[model samples]
Target chain A: MADRVLVAKLGLDGHDRGIKVVARTLRDAGYEVIYTGLFQTPESTVTAAIQEDVDAIGLSMLSGAHLALVPAVMEEQRRAGVSIPVIVGGIIPEDDIPALTKAGVSAVLGPGASAEEVIGAVRGAIDRARREAGGSAPEGEPGGSAPQGEPA
Target chain B: MTRREEWQKAFEKAPLRDADFETMSGLPLEPVYGPADDEDAEYPGVYPYTRGPYASMYRSKLWTMRMFAGFGTATDTNWRFKELLAHGGSGLSTAFDMPTLLGVDSDDPRALGEVGRCGVAVDTLADVEDLYAGIDLEKVTTSMTINSPAAVILAMYVANAEANGAKRANLGGTLQNDILKEYQAQKEFVFPPRPSMRLVADTIEWCAAEMPRWHPVSISGYHIREAGSTAAQELAFTLANGFAYVESALQRGLAVDDFAPRLSFFFNAHIDFFEEIAKYRAARRIWARWMKERYHASSPRSMQMRFHTQTAGVSLTAQQPEVNIVRTAIEALAGVLGGTQSLHTNSMDEALALPTAKAARIALRTQQVIAYESGVANVADPLGGSWFVESLTDEMERLAEETFSYLDDLGHGSMLEGVLQGIEEGWFQNEVADAAYRFDRALNSGRRVFVGANAFTEGNDEDPIEVLKITDEDERRQVKRLAEVRSRRDGDAVERSLASLAAAAADPEVNLMPPLLDAVRTYATLGEIMDRLARVFGRHVEQPSI
Candidate 1:
């Protein structure tokens, strides 16, 4: 089954050309991508992500609201008791990447990351999360492709 | 044999990248062009103004080096503005942060962690005062890039200027009070289209009477191009909006010449060098001809299409970040050759975050090099007579005219009505989305070559440039500042001002500027004023364009 990923744009930032591009790239890679269009709140994003039962959530923000908005998505996912890996991409500064990653973002993809890089991170992050959650995965080895539904 | 036949034969032998030879917008290109395909082009500063807006063009003086700079707190951006002025930047263009752009206060929950992130945050007149600290409003011209709540910001600016003893008639600057384009491209709108247009008309009408030196509205195509529109679409849509604004003002009983001279334009100088130049030339021609022939404007200034150009933000890549310096230089050159009245070159590091001081300096230096070194500015429209350029200009004008006719038909002979209907029907948004989708497909398919992106992906192991980051501490500071301002100001006065502003808003006959100024003076937050007006005008909830 194809891995399902939810892409969302949070906050009042309307610059979505890059996010849309990333969504198309991910969908073209055979991932079942669901895009939450512009002006999404963190609550709405997490709700859609968990309801869709996607393997990973890719949040894109360029209005410099990532620090304030990304953690809300992380917190909401935690509150909702969903363990889907969350990855972020946008015009994020290098200094902020570490903080976001430490805050439980699975991967931080900055500008100029290639399509191959994005797909690889989405797969690796979900696999790592599935293993960390004590789901099916071999110890000390990269997991196989993610399932369409929740990992066993 | 003719040049066309020879070029065709040479093309047949040499082959090409693909079977299609066309511009990015699908404008078919000929193998060669010559004088035989010439249109009835006109001279510079003339009726049609095909060559340039000014007869002397850059020979008299170079286009103003107005760099768009703002980020973090108002005081932080104030420092940047001073730094830019110290570096010989002639004019200032301000960029407001997301919360401010959306007509929200810093403390508003919707603002959250976005304060002072993308641009400068301003919640009251105090912030505006801090933004222009120590800068003489009368001496240097300023252009602000704000929509939706543009009037609120402009009022704060005016109140600040008056406090500083700058007379309204003597102040020179531009307010990007263009709301139609907000619905068409940028999507930063607060109220629906009709009320937004009314606010825009208020600003235009006010500027025509009070601030003679100020440009009230700068009809913009920059955001449209940034949103992935074609060059022709940018020209067509921007001018269409411009015509609509003129008609709206005329409906308000203002003469065409009274407000048209105070009107200006903003366009994007994308990476396509010749195409951008031709686009500018065609833009001036179309605007001038329309103003004189269709609108019956007698004055030259009313007919002229003066514009400011910014290097395309969409053209800047995040991969080879420094390579963006070269891209900006080329785009700046295009703007200069195309006869822009002013220009802002985008920072090379914008794709990463708000530009650092070093990156912004380099971007400004890129323009300085073009102005002082490139010699391209030595002549007025140096490519004016080139057959290839002339042909492209004609083609762009032709395509733009077709769009105009389509819009006219859509509006049932009213450009304003057509624009409103188009926004409602999601026509403009869909057009831009379709263009963007095509560009993405081409990039993925390797049909388009963006260096360091899809092609030439090796040997790019350079260290990343340091980027500017707005921390949570900044948001906290802004919210605290807003809190203090709220406590100190007379809450009753704010309520009274907002109440009267809402009262004026309910009546379509009253111009909202005076009451708006009163509200802003009473220290009503932008969100407060917009919210009150929204009660009357209603908020714009865009229908999804799938």
Candidate 2:
């Protein structure tokens, strides 16, 4: 997660173990991480995303709530006319990744993914969006390169 | 010769460290320990049994391998339970979800989304029936990891055991029935401290008579450690809570010999290796001494403090999750070597999701490897007499004693004061934040390196581990099943039991256990029992969140 990337735990999955680590890592890498505590429905998650005006929304879920939760969140984003890139994280099986991505999720992150890989994916997605929008790369955003452990 | 200056001069970094630089859970760790550390070892199975409860320890039977298991419905997790037993796990540890733990039923509105989430959802005796589906309660020991509603769940277990043709005297298991720590760390609670204490004392008194083989409560320091308290804090707080419970039970007129022997403990095995081992040794010494000196608990079993240990899940990283297996293995070793009676190794993929079957099996294998492959289990307290370990253990015991004395002087070790003043005023949370921030800063400045998280650059490899997913249909099915159980049960009997529970709760001396057992017998779901109590006790709003 970059400074602009947004992170949230979607649905009633209150397990913060994964997302907290992700947030801390991304924050250490200079990404502004927002933590939404337990029991958030998809609507609240998307609403928060729009309000934060973030560059990306990271959903850390457990509780097998992802199948119902992710689609609900995507629909909530559409209904709100917000297309901020969405990234899904948590107990996501490999088979569900394609379906999640096909449902407009920018990327899918599972367990064991290094912080660098998560950073690289979010930055690449963000950089691609900026390129399509015809905006110049933010000076300190590192031109879509993955960040190392140290903040640049 | 001030302690702070003395350590500063010895270590050469006094100016840079916090005033009380120590391991989380508050053990003041030395930069290094050498020779001259257990010169004062106490007699085993006696006062200050610093080494362990029994003289021979694992030279006796090694502590039972009880991996924590519970998820989905009772029937679903019962299947998992049988699998764990088949795979060489010697005991069963049951984990209930937030709702069931809070005394709520699966079909209750508050429990809807939470049902079968963190662990299994047990709503009634039938659900309890599903949990033991085919297992014999008389032969195998079980641990129910619950509080707040511990008595209710325990009663359910008793009823289910009777139905399965096992006498209460023959059943074996532990109910993590401790509640003082619930206010201190875990936020789940049902009644005020007074009523809660009564509930626990009632269970202790009853079990002392009816369930001779059962462990009524596992006084827990595991949650405090998990909540980021220092090792010293964990030891001190857990012991203080134990003292409080003992004092409360005394109020009910149960002799120490009757209940204290059955008391057990639970602890967390964090990443710090030597520090954790010392913490366990320190705990035994502290409890043994206090039981004899403070409460005059004379029986050897009453003096001994035995515990179950779980490898720290908080230490598991979402980044490079495979590393968690390595971490869990090391932590499990620490627990076994420290003399834990049971243990649960965390899954590598835990930082991401509920462990898929592959991850869970790997977690189990980690324990088996430690128990069999690792030569450490060949002897009891393998590092017991090491000079460094002994000295650190002494330091841990001394510090925990001082901390407990400080709390004792401030007032009684009341859970309300501890949570209301200590926690709400941010003493507990601030200490945790300070430790967390220090660790974070150390990582940022390169003082500490989390292998895959920070130093290692296998940065491109994706976490290919499969994850377990639950569906909305599961929730709907649970609700439907609960509704069916409700409609088919004798509604009039259920109402009578619920009403009786309300009356019991109204009077402090009236034991709520019998009514609770009756409610479960009448097929009351967990949520319904909780709702009835909430109607009588009303919900307790938590103190302002930090």
Candidate 3:
């Protein structure tokens, strides 16, 4: 089973060069990546993440609206009962990273992040989410088969 | 063996180690350049223009130092404009905020937090007035960098200029109404390619008849390069787009000579010094030849390629930010040696945020230094006879012709159809993406190096550079201003004007500028006019291809 990751761009900023590189790197690392192309809203991103059942989601925003857009996605994901971790990346200033993390972002990758660093972050984030999801499941459940690996 | 042959043999045996020995476009480089390697070259201001568009080049008049600037509110930008002019900035290049570029008013909910963050915010004709207040529109040439809503913005400019008692014929400036590049690279397109192209044609036709000194469309490859493309791809794709616009105007019954002279170009001055120079030279030769042979234009003005070059923003590094100053200086020199008519040097801090005033001043000074101090501008095409530059220029021209032929075939012997087909099939975007991916992969693998970014470790130095920050309060002010304008304007006039625009849009033969100007004069917001047009011409849905 391949680890499925969903990548998305939020808001009016159309800078996808960084996001596309990240997506390609993740895909090359054997993840089934679903990319939500530019100009996606928070609602559309959350809907796609839930529908795809992605193991993890990555959001990239270069426009300064990340503080507003990211929390909206976090809220939508929470309402949809999805615990999938979402990583954010772009030209985020250092001061805003902690705020994004506090708003439920798993990790924040800024400019100049190497491919290896991005892959390591995404893989580690998914592994941590899977472990926590596995530990919280009821014992002896039919669907409780080791869900560590991606169902896709 | 002869002494030269022996020297060549020794050089081959002990070649430079661990070096790629190729240009960024994958063209192989030789050990040395000499007269024997020089290609046949034409003189400057000649038919082909392989050397340059003008015979004297910068000796007659220096290239205009047109810096792209805008941020915060319109009044804020207006102040910047006045300061730039006072500081010897030759021309104005306007940059709009995301909402205005995306055809949304500053007050829209989707525009929250993004308004005035990237560039200036202009919601209605009132904002445009404030933007150009006290500046003589007739004297100072302005270049507006808006695409999706370019018609609305241009209409606003024309209306504002008229209101200020400036004759349309006396106005001089360029409208970067290039919708093709928006679909291909900038990704700020509102309508589909077909109708968006029609709107561009309408502007060109209107300008050809009304505004004698105005450049209706600046076919741009700057965004395509900024989006990540090779120098060759930038040359090829941008010229293909120019050809597409020419065809669109021709289809509208305008003669080739009528608008081609006013047709300008915008290109990115990437850090590759020799390559960027060759790209510009090759661009002139290719455009001149095509305009004469293929398009059958007899006018020499129509054949010459005049362009504005901006130092590549993508090449700037956030790590060791000040190193970008040197990069911009080199790129500006390349643009001058390549015979650009106008140039903009990017601020070092752009990768982090909109440039602070200090950084922007440094950028303008970089251009001024090149213009005044750099003796390289004394000669027209100083590298005209250089074996290496001439060969590269020839190779680039040949490669661009190949791309042109491919697009022509796709368009069924029409560059217009080829561009339309390319946009619909995502061919242009895919090509740029592939080049970008290759560059990124090479950079990541250490096959290529970007001085401060990929190499030359700074060890995470804590150098605190002041970045220009646009606060949420700016957005609030912009929205309030927009609301005030809406409250004051006559609702009935706005309604009638919008209906007229929608009607004009529905008819294929109707030129949209008149009704568009009418609507803008009624204080109809950018989004209102754009929304009405979108109601008639459906919004574009990008065919996602990663």
Between the candidate structures 1 and 3, which one is better when assessed by lDDT? 3
Tens-place lDDT per residue, model 3, B254-368, is 9999999999999999988999999999999899989999899999999999999999988888787888899999999999988899999999888787898899999999988
Off by over 4 Å in 3: A131-152, B1-41
Instruction: Give the distance in Å from residue B532's predicted Cα in candidate 2 to where it truly belongs.
Output: 0.9
Winner by TM-score: 3
B337 Cα displacement, candidate 1 (Å)? 0.3
Screening candidate 3 with a backbone cut-off below 3 angstroms (N, C-alpha, C), the clashing residue pairs are B411-B418
Give the alpha carbon lDDT tens digit for every residue of B263-300 in model 1: 99999999999999999999999888889988999998
Least accurate stretch of 10 residues (summed lDDT) in model 1 chain B?
Answer: B10-19
Which CAPRI category fits model 1? acceptable
Off by over 4 Å in 2: A1-62, A66-152, B1-40, B109-114, B190-195, B318-322, B356-359, B412-426, B459-463, B471-473, B543-546
Q: Evaluated with lDDT, which candidate comes out highest?
A: 3
RMSD of 2: 10.4
State the local distance difference test value for candidate 1. 0.84
* Model 1 segments more than 4 A misplaced: A1-4, A26-33, A123-152, B1-41
On a 0 to 1 DockQ scale, where is model 2? 0.13
